[model samples]
Target: MAETMTTTQTITVGARRLEVSWAGVTHVGHRRETNQDSFLAEFPLFVVADGMGGHAGGEIASQSTVRRLHDVVDSADVGRSAIEGALERVVKDIAAHPETTDEGTGTTLTGVFIESDDEGSRWVALNIGDSRVYLLRDDHLVQVTTDHSVVQELITAGKLSPEEAEGHPYSNVITRAVGASELTPPDYVTIDVRAGDRFVVCSDGLTKELTDYGIQHFLRQHPTPGAAVDAMLAAALENGGRDNVSLIVVQVGDSSSTEDVHAE
Candidate 1:
């Protein structure tokens, strides 16, 4: 994988403005023959999708969803409703695709949508399946999206511990995903944005290799998104790289207040 690089962009809504620096990287990993993960890092939106299916179905599913989102975002029509509608359309399109019909092709979708109103700027975190969205604020990292996987349900039901779930055979069996069903709806939460907030949106590959503490350690050590993303990818690859790895790190703050940190 190449060294991670950061790109700065700004999101404005009404009278509110958010200066955002972000970086994204994806790898085929040590085991996978093909990369099935796809991502988007445009301003006002960031996404990570982990695809699953037989043959090329996984790749197709992930790419299709991201392309649809790119179109919707490029049209300047963005919001909870827009995202939901776009997902619905993508599902329909996938079902009608010759290669995906009856093949059970699907992809996990997770990320944040930036929105602004008269009050101020806010972030809407969205999720479907096991891919995750995490927030680092006040030096604390919190996972904002819940996984819709068998292991997650087992953990919630008190049938499994977090440590146990890590090695569970059903850990990869996601219960919900985009394009898996026409009725699948993503879970979302809207929260007020704060300066100095950092977000990590990633596939299960990274989490499978590192614990929350490990992730936070790198995030804190690498102050800039570029360095943080690179450090994370290197760690995951070193740990095992058992599956395709994809991630996007985003930091929000005033332009002058945030300093870019690069890895040597």
Candidate 2:
């Protein structure tokens, strides 16, 4: 089972009243031998991390980052700057860990922190590696985070087309990652939100099995957050369950207690 939480806040933005609620879900897919991903559901702050490395090392790296982030977000006061600083600290902690000495363990992190403002809430996203965050609203789906993998670089340099990069031998080789590099920095982006906005944070496994068009179509059809998740899981399994897949979908503008957000 899964849970959803909502917090009501009425903010005026240029004579328009915006009511937004934030909700999220995290799931470990069926075929993975171990779960190397984690997420957070605290209001105004949400995150999803997917780890990589040989052996069980990836799991440790991912969990460490998530735990540190939870502690920072939970203990400190909430604000855009505070959240950003916390993220920086988490990245530094990962890079400095002792286990990263051999081959270097690494993880992809995608997180969002929302802050109430006079106009509405501001959404800030921080990302590293290949994990991503997507924003869906007004029937449009936009990828908010760009991957930090080798294939991404080739695409940027005009050496690879989006389709060609998908099957490239070095597609999975990432240029930067938490714990892999001593001086890794995340790419952070900000967006303004209104009442009916929804967000999805997912690992590459999910995207590998489900195309963006497929994802966009599913979201457009599934009205409830839970149903959308179910459909996504089903589609991935149907595609052969190649790797561990995890995802979190959050809706902003509804209000409820924290407990409900983890119910399932």
TM-score of each: 0.91, 0.81
- Candidate 1 on 23-121: residue-level lDDT in tens? 999999999999999999887789999988877788878998899899878988778778888888788877877788466798999998776556665
**lDDT of candidate 2 over 33-62, digit per residue (tens):** 877777776655677778777656677678
Checking candidate 2 for backbone clashes, the offending pairs are 1-264, 2-264, 6-254, 6-255, 6-256, 7-255, 20-253, 21-252, 21-253, 21-254
Off by over 4 Å in 2: 1-31, 79-101, 116-120, 180-183, 254-264
